[model samples]
Target: MGHGVVLAGLCAALLIIATLAMGCGAMPIRAEDVLGALLRWIGAHPAQGDDAIVLSLRLPRVLMAALAGAGLACSGAVMQGMFRNPLVEPGLIGVSAGSALGAISVIVLGGAASVGWLGSFGVTAAAFAGGLLTTALVYMLGRRRADIATLLLAGVAINAIAMAGIGVLTYMASERQLRDLSLWTLGSLGGTDWRRLLAAAPWIVLSLAWLPLHARALNALLLGEREAGLLGYRTRPLQRRLIALTALATGAAVASCGVIGFVGLLVPHAIRLAWGPDHRLLLPASALGGAILLIGADTVARTMVAPAELPIGILTALLGGPFFLWLLLRARDGGVRA
Candidate 1:
């Protein structure tokens, strides 16, 4: 299929899923009601309780999920292209691990009582900082060698250290702290609101904006760094920019929604399977596919257990795990090549 056709289909699916997502939950609004509320909000109509629920509660959560998913999936596609490995993802590079450590520190060391004062933005900022710092460290370690394997190893080491730090934090946590930390690690969009969404938007948007502009560079890099440089591309600078952008995007996503996994790893690969490996098409299609998958997952999470919602992370992991195993088996069979 053509890139345009694939993109159109993904966007259509995202729109449909998002509309369904807006209507699914404990209260359960209809699709028409969801549309009516959105149109009314657009037209500045007077607010009612149901409109308030749809506009104030569900809309922000849905938008956050879509943005976070798109950003992470695009980052994953870039990482895979840069590393020249189909299996590479945002988490494999330690961004999520570092972000988790940062969040754990805030929740455990700062204490539950402090959350009222610290607010959601405080935790988000710390997580973002941690993700960027860890990714930068990994970049520094790998820059001297300029080897993909070395960079991957550095990320692995950093992720191990970050996980250790999280373990220590868990050990030291109070009951309330432990509860909050546990929930955050599991990941959910339940507590999301306009304020948290606004806080994360700029980083995600800015990072995504930088990605498509580098599509040609990413494509060139796929031909190998030396060849890309011979073609007059500044391979090293491109790598640095891509890594920084990935850190910013992934950090904002982890900060906003906690550690939702698999979208990044799974969405890009799925898009590649259907749309071919052209970075130009891959990045945008992955973004749309990610949005659709995440919104659909979030809808299932909310409705599956009714009043009690499943964590979005758990749902993604459950779905992605089997696919991951299949990839491994395919690789073993020598049928998988990226």
Candidate 2:
């Protein structure tokens, strides 16, 4: 418990450091100035400095990314435990694709930029609706048949269809729309402001608070439906709750951050390996671990090229893809991977 607390503290510190460091960018602001501004804003007695960059720019993006990372990782951990499949990512059951399709629909049909918060609003709603709808469809199609395999396969089919829709939208998009879509898809912590953060903060906080409660329940469910049922845990209700929570968190993330992948898949597994597979510890640890990793990656994305920025999502894939492949190979020995 002490170790968990210590590690959580370390993760939080690293997240802050990474956020501040990444915020420095090519913005021509000193770290001290940024820190002082932040302190002053937070009601601390800061000596002096303008909070222009901290308030107007960096703070929101960093916060948004951190929230998104934590949310996605939490969702992934829950999904894996619920499904008893480590390879199961937040999108494995078509949630991500559903979100993407919703965002695209808004982009193409609603003229995303014309309305103020409409872009985010429409996209977020679409994503949530899509995720739930897809899940319901998959569940309905597979449940009566008593086939988990078919359910997953249906998710795949739905994902492919959603991707096809996205492709068509992209193909028909104007140059500006294409550019907007590309950046959104690639993912960035670059252009966030307070309003976006306000939209995202609630869901992330709610998820952070709510998701961990399922730790014991998830552990029980992992032992199979009958075992879980015999232990006074209702399997179907638990599964529904897990799916809903996972979808809500992931949908909110996709709504805010676009489709940043692998944080969810990678973070929980790393925590499980280090701290043992206890969801009680794994859930919060994965949240902090994910935030740290993302903030760190975003820092590199900003500084590695200097004066120019890379998408944070690109950096995550570069780091996570190889690790995922290695995980796959190791799992071939019939151990828990992903």
Candidate 3:
């Protein structure tokens, strides 16, 4: 299919899933009510109690999920393009692990005494800092060698260290802290509000805005660094900019939604399968695909157990883990490459 057709389909699916997500929570607003509530919010109609639920509770959560998923997936597509490796993702380079460690530290150290908005801000800030710092460190390490392999290795080491840190924090955590940490690590859109979404929006939006502008540069880099340089592309600056964007986007997402995985890896790969590896098409399509997947997953998570919502990370992992294994097997069979 053409890019336009694929993107349109993905956008339509995303809208359907998002609407379902808005309607399918514990209170269970009807589809028409959800649309009516949205219309009322825009001053097209009078308000009602259902409008309050949709406007106040569900809308922010749905928007956050879509934004988080789009940011992560676009970050992943950029990473894959920069490294020329299909397997690379935000978590592969320690962004999620570092963010998790930071969030866990806050939960463990800050305690129940730090309740409310201040506490939430503390965690989000720490997570963003951790993710950015880790990405920077990895970038620095890889810069010395100026090679993708070195960067990948640096990421592996950083990821290991970050995970160890998270484990230590987990051990030191009190029961409540541990419980909170577990939920954050597993990921959820359940606790989101307009405030948290606003906090995350600037970073996500800035990163998303910056990434697509480098599509041609990413495409050039795919031809190898020497060839890209030969073609007059500034390899170093492009790589640095892409890394920074990735850090910013992924950090914001991790801060907002916890350690949701595989949207990055899965979305880009699937988009590539359908549309080929053209970065321009791949990047936006991956974002849309990621949004669709996460919204659908979030819907299932909220409604599957009724009053008790599932952590979205578990659902994505359950789906993506098998897909990842299949990719690995396919690569081994010579059907794909790094």
Candidate 4:
């Protein structure tokens, strides 16, 4: 209804969805028991039976989804603000493609499952590195400083190159590696554990914390570059910093979760349409909405096709595709009105 009301609702929804999510799936633990597991988790006591399942299996996955969703949705919100385009999503800037290439490289060329935790470690680092490298390259290639279009075009070029690189890797991959690579592209939280969660958490957390600090700057940018400059905000540096932060955050998400599609793409827009566009409200609201959306998506992904988990990406894409079409049609209607 209103900003604070919306924010409070989202916070409550996230908690409920997260708790329900932990309790869903094959074992179907009760929500209260799930709460008990969480409360007992802090004591460092090794939980047995359902407690173990809740703590060891579900908790990390749910938290990962929440963090990834938060980072991605926040990034999408920032990117949309920077470009002033409702349809713009974080992946349009090459973070997902770059992260995909990095992970694919590891699965196809670098590691074997037999190598223990090091393999997962390699994939995570490589994905993050790939994202940062792509960001730098995009900034360099698209370095018109004041032209947002150049940066976006640069991202397109990088995405193509990275996709081609992924193609080559896909061709060279062993059967098992190919399967793994394909799944990575499709996205999932199946491999999530505390170790994997910890790896990407800091980047997501850093971006979540740091990105919102620039809300006022984003608000300024909404008024056009010249106007923002008149207001004492240097548009170029601000845009660059926002992109970098969003990339780091989105990159970590893509790396860890493989390539979740729509949370980043749609969540921010949902928040904006329902709650309005003040970044002070929009940013945090997007974060909570993202978490709730992903947790819900993931729960359905794992359950709807029980015993066989659907790739989370596919589920989000399926849901996002129609919503996106609605957005386009809504824009068309708005144009007629104007």
lDDT of 1 at 167: 85
Best by lDDT: 3
lDDT of 4 at 53: 90
- lDDT by residue for model 1 over 262-295, one digit each (tens)? 7888999988887788999999988888888888
- Model 2, 1-338: lDDT tens per residue? 56567576857686567546635677656666777777787895644655766777777777777788888888878877876667666655677778777777787777774466656677667777776677666555644553345545776898899889889989888887786676547777766778767766776788788889989998997787799999999888877877777777777777677777788888988887777878888888888777777777777888889888888788888877897787667767656432
Question: Against the hidden reference, what TM-scores do the models get?
Answer: 0.90, 0.88, 0.90, 0.88
Model 1 residue 156 lDDT score? 80
Off by over 4 Å in 1: 110-119, 136-157
Pairs of residues at least 3 apart in sequence or in different chains that clash in candidate 3: none
Query: Which is the winner by TM-score between candidate 2 and candidate 3?
Result: 3
Error of 1 at 186 (Å): 1.1
Scored by lDDT, model 3 comes in at 0.82
Candidate 4 on 1-338: residue-level lDDT in tens?
67778778888889999999999999899999998888878876666569989988999999999999999899889877876667667566677789888878877887543365676567767777787787666645544453545655776788899889999998998887776776667889887889878878988899999998989988987877788999999888888788678877877788778878767769888777777789999999999988888888889999999998989999888888898678767767773111
lDDT of each: 0.81, 0.74, 0.82, 0.81
Clashing residue pairs in candidate 2, if any?
Answer: none
TM-score, candidate number 1: 0.90
Task: Point out the higher-scoring one by TM-score: 1 or 4.
Answer: 1
CA shift of 234, model 4, Å: 2.6
